[model samples]
Target: MTVKKILGAAAGALGLMWVVRAAWGIPSAIGASMSAIQPYASGAVSYRDRHFHNTEPGSQIVAGSARSLLYSALTRRNAGHPRGVIPLQTPVVPTEAADLAVTWYGHASALIEVDGYRILADPVWSDRVSPSAIIGPTRMHPVPSPLSDLPPVDAVIISHDHYDHLDKATIRSLVAAQTAPFLVPIGIGAHLRHWGVPEHRIVELDWGGSVSLAALGRTREGTDLVLTCTEARHFSGRGLVRNTTLWASWSIVGATRRAYFGGDTGYTKAFAEAGTALGPFDLTLLPIGAYDERWADVHMNPEEAVRAHADLCVGDPGHGLLVPIHWATFNLAFHGWSEPVHRMVEAARAAGTAVAVPVPGQRVDPNGLSPRDSWWEDVG
Candidate 1:
């Protein structure tokens, strides 16, 4: 064939490939639309004008202009990639649960073992967190445990519908692997329903709403797990439109121990309210990563995570074990890969807070919490 003919064929093939890749991502990207979630969204007290709103006014995100967003996107201020392989722990099946324990499975995915019942939080097991499998943020480390490896959990708690937290691929796998109900923030069930999760297995709630294990437990013992959907200072959207679904933190209360899962949030007064109403917790898993100056009001920095931990644990900073999440997995912001945990340790010491920086898949028991070894120092 002539050179011109070969070039024409190559261009045509590339164009076709682009079209195919875009088409493959469209379904997952355009998740549940406003129309599909309207009924549930309208019922939420925080929802207004066909969207959910954060109670805090003057959020940097809402005030941010398109030009500022463009600028931030163009800037790469930090080396967000880790220098060495992230160490992983082999997760073991616990024959019985501890009074309060947490297994960090990298990023926001964790197994909170409290009072003999297990609750998995934001369990994203996919290799990449994106609408398209070929693009977006890929995992820095292999998943410590496969979905099939997970023991039966009493409940699965989802904090929001962000691609990183509320993963479609992970949800579908959990639907088949475990018998637990998915306790998600309001309107998130719409996305679950769209992706073919059974309606009976989904328990959607607005902020301050709850589900007791007696109602959702698969066992005859009917575990004492109480999951409350609490407020978070973040926005949500899988596609162009945002906040059709609510974002939230969670209060996971068992019979004798309680834990708080800060799915994702900025510093907010709501943490104080949650502490006053439902806390003095045994453990608190707070997000301490993916924070940028451009969206500081949406995602909490490591220092803020320490502060929030203090607020939620009733000012007794040393009371609960604070395990940092939303970091070490995906490079979502312009901060050195290990910066979050390092800053968190510094701030925690100043605040007299007790923290357990668990390696991905390492289990942490708050009652006899082990000393933090600064594992990320070498890896970073």
Candidate 2:
């Protein structure tokens, strides 16, 4: 064989061997090495390719453009990269003690406190959001809260099996630290179970299916909290195969308040289903970052987020306060780091929607929220 051909074959063989060893589970979470075994977990496992994205039977991926894998990648900008430096206003920390509160642990990770119960959503504490930590999109900023110091959470709600949302290392650490149950959508349990989490500790639900914690387990306040699995228009996968598991958003109804956690998805009418079935959330944690014209339909822009809140609340524009996530921490999309929030603010202002753009760790209430104008401008 030619020298280059021989080297390529050797590298491919090594990659195959790596996948076989890492698929079972990691030995430790403290410093778990990244692996290439991306697990596919979505409801549309049978038809997850481009056919599912079409609006109609044979419609185009976009209105008029042909879909190509290369073009489908999220937008990227070379001019306004963060220069590998971001500063916090003052080491902001998320609060755990509140009747209704949310602490953004940078990106999509949040500590949600409602009705005296704590629920964590899409907690990605890893440094990178990809199958291999050595490659893929690394975080531009540090996590707000340390994993070891996290307060006891009632439940950990995973939206999907994406590396960013359902991190294996973080999940392993969480299982060791807290005595909470994991609430995930259908098929995600396979991934959690594979990660060495106890079967009894996991509660998996499908769209509109509900799991009542008080009925199944106990909480600090001795009050029952309901987590309803809501639908989202998104695809999921981890390894060479995709969509073998389910993906979903979540609606958390605690004793005193109601909150919605939209993990990661494109724009879809499914939000209306969640509203009709679950409805009128006090706070909606929506994805408003990593959006572009190329993938805007699947991912809502900021204004679309406002629209989604309205739809989730049955067309009431200002029914709930919008807290934005899925941005600021990772370099997943090519827009300027803060572009999503900026556009969202402009859209929210014109639409009369309430929004609180909290610093990564800052806590916020659905009511009596503060408006921080131009917070991300400094970072950009």
Instruction: Please report the candidate that would top TM-score against the real structure.
Output: 1
Candidate 1, position 199, lDDT: 98
The Cα local distance difference test for each model comes to 0.87, 0.73
lDDT of 2: 0.73
Candidate 2 lDDT over 75-138, as tens digits, reads 3344235654565432333444566778788778998877878898998888977656455677
- Measured over all alpha carbons after superposition, the RMSD of each candidate to the real structure, in angstroms, is 1.9, 5.9
Model 2 scores a TM of 0.81
RMSD of 1: 1.9
Q: Report the poorest 10 consecutive residues by lDDT, candidate 1.
A: 215-224
